[model samples]
Target: MRSMHSMRIASFRVQNYKCFVDTGEIKLTPGFNVFIGRNDAGKSALMEALSLRHTHNPHRSLETVRTPTSEPPSSAPTSVAYDLSPEELRQHLTALASFFLPTGPNASASVFATFRSLLETGDRFNADWANGVVVKADLAGLGGLRRDANRYASVLNLAHPSDVQLALQNEITGSYSSYGVVLANWLRDKAYAFRAERLGLGRCAAGPDKVLSPNAQNLAAVLNVLSSSNPARYKRLVEHVRIVFPHISGITSVIVEGSSVEARVWSIPLESERSDLSVPLNQSGTGIGQVLAILYVVVTSDLPSVILIDEPQSFLHPGAVRKLLEILRSYSQHQYIITTHSPTLITLTENDQLFAVRRQEGTNVSTVALIDPNRQDDLRMSLADVGVRLGDVFGADAILWVEGKTEETCFPELLRQLTKTPLHGVQILGVDSTDELGAKNAQRVFEIYSRLAGTASLLPPAVAFILDKEQRSETEIANIERMGRGMVRWLPFRMYENYLLQSACIANLLNAEDASSGKAVSSEDVQAWMERHGGEKKYFAPREPTAYSDADWPQHVHGAKLLHDLFNEFTDARVSYDKVKHGVLLTRQLLPNPSGALSELCKILDELIRGAPSYTE
Candidate 1:
C-alpha cells in the first residue's frame, strides 16, 4: 500500500462553509501546519469543511450555512409566472438547479437533478419536508447558483425585468459547463483531503481490519493487510514506531474470527528480552493505540497530500507527543494541518507553523490568522518597544511552562481553586519532564518569555512560567531569576509532587474518596506511611527503594512513586489520571478546605489573577 507519489494540498479556500463566511483562501506549508486556538473557536468546524470537502449537494450546503435565527427570509417566490402541471414544474426547476451543482464539464447533472427529486403524491417534492415552508427543495437548490447568477445580474442590472430574466437565461443555457464530468471524476478520485486524527479508538479489539476509517477503528485489519501485503511499508512503520516505544521489535497481526485481525507487538525484554513476549499493541499503554493508528495511516494508504489531524496529542504523554511530532516532521512529502491544545506540543513547533484560530467578533463566523513566531514583523517589533512579546500576541494572558505531566496535571487544579476567581485567559503548559539541563531551562524561559510576556513590569504576571526547581544551584537560580525577572518561577520544593506532599494536600486528597466509594488513604495511615518512609525527617520526599516493611507501608496513596503509580494508571478503563483531567476533581476537593501547603502556590496564582502586588505593600 505504498503511496503512488507524494502529494500536498497547496491551499484550501472556504466560501459558505461552517463558521466560515467566505474565508477567502489560506495557504499551507508542505511539512506541518499547526492550527492552535481556544475551544469553541471553529477548529472543529474548519476540519469538517476540510473533511467533507466542497462536494455535498446544494441543499446540504444551504442547510450547513451559518444562518442567524434572528433573520428569516421574508418570502420566496415559488411560482414562476404561468400555471403548469407538476411534471412541468419539477422538470423546469430541476433543470435550472442542475446548473448549480459543481458546474463544469466534469459535473454530474443527474446528481443535481435527482436531489430531493420526488414530490409528495408524485406532485409534492418530499413527504419528509412537506410541511409548510416558504421555499421548497427546487427553490432551496437555487442557493449554490448565486455565484453564476450574480455574474449575469452584474452585467444586466440596468436592463428591463423581462429582458434581464432573458439575459440570465441566455447566460446559463448559452454557455457550456462541464460540471458533470468534473464532479464525476472527483467522486471517483482518491486524491483529495486525507485525514487521521484523535477520534474514538475503543478498547483493544481484534476487529476486521479490512479498511481503516477516520479513527482506525479497524486497526487490526489495517495492520494485518499492510503487514501481509506490504511488508516494506509495515517494516517502515515499525521502525518509526520503535522510536517512541523502544520495547517493540516488530508488529504482527493475526487473523481472528469474523474477519477481524488481532494485532500485537513483539517487544524486546527490558534486558536481552525474549522473542516470546507479545503485548496487545492497543492495551499496552495510554496512547499506543492512537500512535499506532496514525503511523499505520501513513504507511498503508493512498492518501491525498493534504493530511488533516485534529487534536493529535490526545491520550499521549508529553514524551509520546514529542515522538509523534518527530514522525510527522519526517514525512515531508505530505502537507500537514494539525490542531492541538497542548503547550508542550506548541513548543515543539516554530512560529511559522503556528496559526491562531478565533471567532470573528459578534459573528458565528471564525477565521484563522498566521502568527509570526520569529517575532520579526513590524507590528511585533513595535509591541516589543512597549514590552509585549510576539508570543504574547495570540495566546492566553498567563502561561505557566512547567517541567512534566505531574506538574502540568496538578498545579492548575490547585491554582484554579486558590485563585477562586475564574481563569478564562490563563494557561499552564508543560515543556518537558526531565531536569538534566538547568542552563537550557533558563535559556528557554528567556526565549519564550521575551516573546510571550506583554508588560515590562518586573513580573509580567499576564504571561509567565513555572519550571521545577530541580535543586538548581544558587548561581543557576540567580541566572533564572535574571531572565524571569520574578515573572518566571521555580518551585521552592523539589518538584510538583513535593507540593502534593504538603500535609494539608495529603489530608485533602485522602479524604475526598472514602472506602465506601472505593478505597482512600486515611490521614493517620498517611502519617504512618510518611514516618515509615522517613518523609517527616527527610527534607524532600523519599525518592525510592525504602527499607520499610512492604506490609507496614500505608495502604493509600503515599510516596512519590506510589503517587505516580496511582496516577500512572493509563489503561484502567474505570480510572483515568492525566495532566488535564483529575486536576479539576482534585481542585474541587481542595477548594472548600484550603491548604496551607499551597500557600507559596497561592501568591504565584494571585499574581496571575490580579497583576503582581506592589513590593512596598
Candidate 2:
C-alpha cells in the first residue's frame, strides 16, 4: 500500500458559508496544519466547509449552510472551491476517460493526450459537464454536447465512432452524475474526521471491513479484520496504544457464539496482585476509546489522507496528547488539520503552519492570521520555553512585572501564602533589570509598555512594575518613581534575596545538599556565621552603624553576595546556592513564618492587590 500521493488539495476558498462571507483562499501545508482560536471563531466552520466539499450526499442542501442575509439564499450561493494540482486534474480526467475509450494500443495514449489538451487549453469541463453528456444523453443532452462539442473534441475523437455510440448507449446508464463523483469518492476514502463526542462504538457485525469510519463507529469490525489479516499492524497499534496507556496489555476480539458478530476489547495485565482483566472497548472510558480510535486510523492508513481533528486533548491527559502527536508526526503520510484550544497541543506539535482564527467584532465574518513560527517572539514558542504566552498576559486581569526569573518564581509563592488563595488572573512576569531598561532614566519602561498595549488591544488594562533596589541611591529611586509616574515600585531592601535571610531555611537546604557526605550545617552555625560577617559597619542600616544592635543588617547587606560567601565557607558541604533554585526554596520556607523584612514585603503586595483593578469571574 503506497502512502505518498502526487495529488493534494493545495488551497481552498469558502464563500458565504456560516461565519465566512468570503474567506479569501486559505492555503494549507502538505503536512501538519493547525487552526487555533477561541470558541465560535470559525475554526470548526472551516472543517465543515471541507466536509461539505467531499461528502457523499449530493442533495445535501447549501440552503442551511449559507450565511443569513435579507436577500434570497440562491442570490449568493454558498460554495467551497478547491484548487488542485495539474496531476490531480489529470487523475480525475483519466478516471472519467476510462468509461468512454476502448481497450486498444493507443487507447491509454489517446486518453492522456485528450485530457492533456483539455488542461493545456484551459478548456476543462465544469462540475456538471458529465451530468449532461454522460448521465442524461437524451436529444436535449446531445444538443447541449453539440453546442460545446468543439471544446471537448479531443475527448470525443479519442473513441471510435462505434465505441462512442456504444458508450452513449451503455456507459451513460451508469450511476455517476458527474466527473467529480470519482474525485469525491476518492477524497471520501482518504479523509477522516475525528469527533470525540461521536466516537462511541458497539458490537459490529463480523466482516472483512477494515476501513475505520470517520467517527470510528465501525471500530470493532475494523479491528477484527486487522487482527486476522494483518496481525503485525494490529500488534503495532497495540504497542502505540500502550505507550499512551501502559495498562493496555493487548487487544483481542470476542465473537458471539451463534452469530457473526465480534466485539473489540483490550486486556489489562495483572497489577498489585490482581489477575489480568479484559474489558470491551464500549465499556472502557471515553479517553481510552478515543486513543484507540485515533491510533487505529493513524496506524492503518495506507494512503495519503486528510485527518480533521477538533480538540484532540479533550478526553486525554496531557502526556497522552504529547505521545499522540509524536506518533502522528512519525507517520508523515497524512496531512493533519487540527483545531485546538489547548496551549499544550499548540506548543507540543512541530506544526508546518499555524493559523490564528478570530471572528471580527460586530460582524459575522471570521478572519485568519498566519502566525510565523520563525519569529523571535512567536507566542506558541514562548509558551514552550517559559510556559507563558503574550495572549495569556493580555487576558490576565492584572500584570505584575518582576526583576528576573528568580523573583518571578518566588513572588507567586509568597503571594499565595499571604493571600491564602491563588491570585486569580494575576500574571507575574520576569523582565530585565533597571539598567537594561534604560541607563539614563526609567521613561523607556513606560515606552515599551505602551508599545505592547497598543497592539490589537492585547494587553491587560491594569499593570504594575517592581524591581530590586539594587544599590540605587534614594535620589535615583525618587527620580525613577517620578519618571515612571508611580507605576514602578522599587524594593526597600538591596534585593529580593534579603527577604530570605532565615538561618533555619539556609541550614535545611545545606543539609539536604550534603546528605550523601554525612555532613550537616546547623541553624546555630548559620546564625553565628551571619552575625560575624553581617555586623560590619559597611552592612549597617541608614548608611551608618552606631551599634550592632541598632543596625538592620538584612536591610543593608547585599543578600546575594552574603549567600555566595556562605556557600564558599561551607567547603565540607556539597551545597551551592543557585539563585533560581535556592531562592525559590528559601522563599517557600520563609513564607509560612515571615521575618520582619518578609512581613514588610507582604504589606507591599497587599497594597498592590488592593490598588489593582477588580474583575468579576
Best by lDDT: 2
Error of 2 at 74 (Å): 3.9
User: Lowest summed-lDDT stretch of 10 residues in model 1?
Assistant: 125-134
lDDT of 2 by residue, 1-617 (tens): 12224334455555555676666767777777887777787777777666543222111123334444434233222232233444444444444544332212324344434434434332212111111111112111122221221122123323443222112212222233333344444554556776557455656767778878765777777888898899999989888877666557666665666544545445545343333356667777677777777778879976456778777767776546655775677677677888876664553222378877777776667876677754535654434432334444454556677777687767766665665423444556676523334524344666677676668675665457787777567887777677566688878887898888889999888777667767678999998888777765544444664332445666667788778778768744256678876887788777668887787787787667556665211
Runs of candidate 2 exceeding 4 Å displacement: 1-7, 53-72, 75-176, 257-267, 270-276, 348-351, 374-617
Score candidate 1 by lDDT.
Answer: 0.48
Tens digit per residue, CA lDDT, model 1, 1-617: 11123334445555444465545556666567777766677776666555543333221223343365443222211111111123333333332323333222322343334332422112211100101121212222333442331222111212342221111222232433333222222222222333333333433355434446654566776677777777888888887777666556777777556645567777764365453577665556646666777676665555333456666545654445555665665555545677765444453222126667777667676777776643447324323222333233233434456665555555654554465433333445555532322225556656555664455633224345676655466787778778777766666544554444434455455445332445555567655655554333233333343333443222222335544444333123233333323343454456667556566577776665444221110
Q: For candidate 1, give the lDDT of residue 436.
A: 24
TM-score for each prediction?
A: 0.40, 0.49
Candidate 2 TM-score, true structure as reference: 0.49
Alpha-carbon shift of residue 4 in model 1 (angstroms)? 14
What residue pairs are clashing in model 2? Answer: none
Model 1 stretches astray by more than 4 angstroms: 1-6, 16-18, 53-215, 247-250, 265-286, 301-304, 347-352, 361-363, 372-617
